[model samples]
Target chain A: MSAGVRLEGLRKSYGAVEVIRGVDLDIEPQEFVVFVGPSGCGKSTLLRMIAGLEEITGGDLYIGERRMNDTDASRRGIAMVFQSYALYPHMTVRENMGFALKYAGVKKPEIKAQVDEAARILGLDQLMDRRPKDLSGGQRQRVAIGRAIVRHPEVFLFDEPLSNLDAELRVQMRIEIARLHSELKSTIVYVTHDQVEAMTLADKIVVLRDGRIEQVGTPLDLYDDPDNLFVAGFIGSPKMNFLPAELSGGALTLVEHGGQTVPLPPLGRAPQEGERVTLGIRPEHFRKEGSAALEVDVEIVENLGGETYVYARQAGSDVLTIATGGARGLRQGDRMTARFDPSDALLFNREGLRIR
Target chain B: MSDVAAHRLDPEAAEPSARAALRGPDGPGRDMIGPAVKYIVLSLAAFVSVFPFFWMLVGTTNSSYDIVRGKAWFGDQLLVNLGNLIEQVDLPRVLFNSFYIAIISTVATLLVSSLAGYAFEIFRHKWRERIFAALLLMLSIPFAALMVPLFVMMASAGLINTYSAIILPTIANIFIIFYFRQATKAFPHELRDAAKIDGLKEWQIFLRVYMPVMRSTYAAATIIVFTLTWNNYLWPLIVLQTNDMKTMVLTISSLNSAYTPDFGVIMVATVITTLPTLIIFFLLQRLFVQGMLGSVK
Candidate 1:
């Protein structure tokens, strides 16, 4: 059975420095939540705090109505898969899965049955007798998962479990994990620095930075409607481009490009006229035909078979990425006109908070 | 150095057998000079280290006069020497005493030292490092310095000539504890965390996960502790007074001090005393190497 987790004002500080600064979240039962951020962003710290592997400096952590702040890690009714896969190197996969149950005084038949069932779920029946060192990285990762699955913890915690695998294996495991989440229907709180993993696996994504939550939303929601500049930049590949602008003459005028102005749609919280702001636009949003257009010189052309990205820049401006058709005959230093709907542009104030 | 240079000038002249025997399938480098030179040096080193044991074994078979005359070959006096050995010492009793003390001391020291080492590493705190530093200091202090007070404590406790007196002082071995502590650092902390999530208590995790994962370390410690306690001479010599309670080491020392010391009998006794340690080292030599590798690395 899955359990809902509620963390209130969760604060963790080491000596004078606070790592997880006052995080509050309500993770629903059976929800697949991912905490994603850059390295040293306190995402893993928050995950470990919930796992009870770390002492909570201050917080109220409730798992299924039980306060877990002071509970021992074993009593937390949780299982974690570490980045290293952390399988007992000396034990066979079967023994590693059944080790805790044996120590817990579970009946021998029950332990065997549980381990076999978990092995079947993880497709590890053939590898049950192999020690961790003998298995390939992906197989060892599955065994690590099987060990956790055998315990049937209420919540599964994964800390960058696929970080060690090669790219192909990581994608395969990512799909497998999504399928497992659906089949098992267990609450999971996964932490990763890889935004792609977060986008693919999470029911809800919690983006964090500097020990604070920047935004929390679904993958598409974060990509489309970021509350701040950090979430907008962190969530998408090819990254959203930012151009410095000043609100003038009823439109945002590019500060770097002289005499260039882009029209803006009516926003819920518009910035003051003549104030400095950042105009945000996703690379894929640029089109060959639209209401707004900008002239740029192509800096680099990346032909990725299906899609080509034109890295272009205006005079006195940073390079801007524009996702264009593959092999459009665009070469470096070629002048191009990129266009997008005015409504597609997201405006952020000088402090980087979203205006709409 | 000249030999190396000579081979380097014409690398094609390298010995095929040396390369074939010494080179691993995917091992680095092409030169046979390194491994060839290594083989010669290692065999010489092995002979140098093992020569004393070889000399003692030769002496065990020779008469005392012939031994003093520096006889190098095996003689026909081994049986007579053993007979003299039995007459000079109650062989069974002393062997039994030594075995009992050694086996018990080794087991106890391993348990105590390994646990301390595991704790100092896994449950690290500021004070643990400070206390560990103090222990390292204790290791540097001569055992001879503590001998008088230790003897006084044993005498006051009415434990003089007892196995407990000989075994007690050697049990809290700082060196072995230091080794275990360093080895424990190499143990994957994530395994401990995973075990915790799997519903194992701290002690259960240590016993089930950490212990099996670190069997190499304990094997190395076993050989080390057993050898140390088995051949421990000075403390046993001073503490054990009665002939019946005497260890093999004390008995050998007693035999050596006699006016007409039976060198052949003493050699036989030394051979008997060293056999168990040699056997232990041989059995766990691989584990000893791995354990040292883990700790030092």
Candidate 2:
């Protein structure tokens, strides 16, 4: 029912300034792919290029088996839900859902049947006569997705569709979208600046930075094993903590950790003795019972109902956060040593490339 | 123990010198104009704006003698004035001529101008911007300056004494084009992109999506264009050589220029000529408000 999307050497430039540098990717059919990046990282631009809303400056874009760089958007058989919903203001919800099909020369009853099916799926049957301006934000977004559904498009493109909704509504709609993807069994390319959204909804996540692919992997794979500093820093919620360290005699010594040290395990290509490196530890990786240890001068503590985050630091050093399960009797100005498994430490060279 | 010092602080702080004097030397808290004064000023403005229409209405109900005497109230001579107005001008035939010319020209003008506006804005090129700037500059040029050459062009085309002479010259109105260009800026580009994805052609997108989305803009444009074309005087007077070809404006003006002009009859003609514009305004006013609201959204 859906086609795979592929981009080879995809590039976009506005005269001298290239917004999208060379990007290469292949999205499997029926896969939920999320494009996540910081602002100006060209994630939305990339999505728009696939939707054919933006012109391909230099690359081959293929939908199904067709080279779609020159194909009209409507002919490419893809549908997009814009950030603004982009619904016709004067048209009813039913009309908005049915409009594209009507113009595609479908029979009246077939259009009605498709629209009715989409409405039932979206829980918009009762609101069919309502205008976009009259609907709530979440309802309007549902109608927008309904509009896309009626097109029977091969792939779906969503550009920050939930960014405009409230926090609760965003979570609700995120699940709704994930369910839709599964139900339709169509390839979906979703773009967002939010890592959380990418993590929950994506079957595979594509991390973009400065118009280049930084990393492409499953959400947990990226969190557990990032290729570089950017992916490691971006994927985790309480961002993985980095402490300056030096390797000497197969041992890693924390340069700013009050003389704390741990043995370095052998890697694919180990660093030289006395070479500088950064050791990354996720906040949740810290434990009360482990081998490697560093004493921390606690500064702030945030306790959620389920877990508590201890934001602490060594003397004259940046804050390193530690997450411990449940309520721990921790206080600011309380000095304590937090421990972590030696094998859990991630080492990066001065250039931010992984040492292993 | 510190009564005088506290008293000194009270007076100093009681003064609102820290705030600007633009709020009438007092704070806005104390200086807001009361609603009574607001209503008074608004009523005066309303009276000023409506006075001329009221005077015309009164004149329709008065005789020439009473109108010259500055009778401001309704008189019992309305039937007589109407009879005289129809007597001088073949009222129905002249109105039909004006209506046909104005409506057709307005529809044409809106189409051409809005298309030009949409293209100039959406499909921008280096040369199109230059042309748009030139069009804006042309708006500053008095139509009177172009009148003679325009008439000659119409005459050479053998369109003299025809409605085409009047309609053709004014159909590509620079002002309306500028207006549509400005309004078209507020149109969301995403709508067009969505329409394109729906398989609409460029022209079909313009016709189906843009036309419906910018409905308020068109309504406002329609009322404005209709009024301007209906009240068009100088060009039609020069080109439309026959009395049968004359518009309401030319007809009414000729009635006014009679050696012994009947003031009451001219007023009746003026009142009747104004009715269509007023009716159009009333009918489209709701649309105008709705459009304004939509534009803001």
Judge candidate 2 against the unseen true structure and give its global Cα lDDT, from 0 to 1. 0.89
Task: List CA RMSD, all candidates.
Answer: 5.7, 4.0
**How well is each residue in B200-252 modelled by candidate 1, as lDDT tens digits?**
78887888888888988998999989998998898888888889999998888
Off by over 4 Å in 1: B1-44, B295-297
Docking class of 1: medium
- TM per candidate comes to 0.91, 0.91
DockQ for model 2? 0.71
lDDT of 1 by residue, A1-356 (tens): 99999999999998889999999999999999999998899999899999998889987999989999999887888988999998888889999999878877899999999999999998998988888879999998898888889888899999999999999999999999999999999999999988889989999999999999999999999999999999988889989999899988788898887759989756976677899999999999899889889999999999999999999998988889999966579988899999988799899998999997
Query: Candidates' lDDT values, in order?
Result: 0.90, 0.89
**Candidate 2 per-residue C-alpha lDDT over A1-356 given as tens digits, one digit per residue, 9 for 90 to 100:** 89999999999998789999999999999999999988999999999899888899998999999999999889999999988898988899989999999998999999999999999999999999999999999999999999999999999999999999999999999999999998999999999888889999999999999999999999999998899999999998899999888987788988887657787744788898889999999998898878888888889999897999999988878899899889579899999888988688798999998877
What are the chain A TM-scores for all the models, listed individually? 0.98, 0.98
Q: Can you write out model 2's per-residue Cα lDDT over B152-265, one digit (the tens) per residue?
A: 888899999998887887789888888888888889888888888888899998998899888888888889899999998888888888888878889888988889889999
Please state the error at residue A55 of candidate 2 in Å: 1.9
Ten residues in sequence with the least summed lDDT for candidate 1 chain B = B18-27
